[model samples]
Target: MAEVKSMFRDILSKQLPVEDITTMVLRKPKLLPLKSLTLEKLKKMHQAVQETTHQQEMVEKEQQQITH
Candidate 1:
């Protein structure tokens, strides 16, 4: 997670555009945080967050590669 955050920082430092990042990070359908979410629902939300974070890292990596 820290590595992904650092990669995102690196991408922004290199002036990669934010639109792509936002799309990659936010386009996924997030699980609703219901007060009564079952254990499975909680797990799905965690999975979604992990996947979203991974996608952001991938986008940042691609952008950095292009800039270099």
Candidate 2:
């Protein structure tokens, strides 16, 4: 009975491994001090272009409905 208990304990230890998990290195993100003027201007231009395209699509849809 004692030998049987020792064998069971050995099996349990083998099935369940014991070890410390590796931890990831912590890092801090770099902060930007200011935004670029050129980039801001480009973003505004892109938004204007998108609005113009949307307006044109709406106009085309209106004309199609009238013709049909």
TM-score result, candidate 1: 0.45
Q: What lDDT score belongs to each candidate, Candidate 1 first?
A: 0.87, 0.88
Model 2 vs. true fold: TM: 0.50
The segments of candidate 2 whose C-alpha lies over 4 angstroms from its true place after superposition are 1-34
Flag regions of model 1 displaced more than 4 Å.
Answer: 1-37
**TM-score top scorer:** 2
Which residue pairs come into collision in candidate 2? Answer: none
Worst 10 residues of 1 by lDDT: 17-26
Please provide, for model 2 over 1-68, each residue's C-alpha lDDT reduced to its tens digit, 9 standing for 90 to 100.
99999999999877734443355667998888586889899999999999999999999999999999
What is candidate 1's lDDT per residue for 1-68, written digit by digit as tens?
99999999998788956775676444778797656658778899999999999999999999999999
RMSD values for the candidates in order, in angstroms, are: 32.8, 13.3
> Per-prediction TM-score, please?
0.45, 0.50
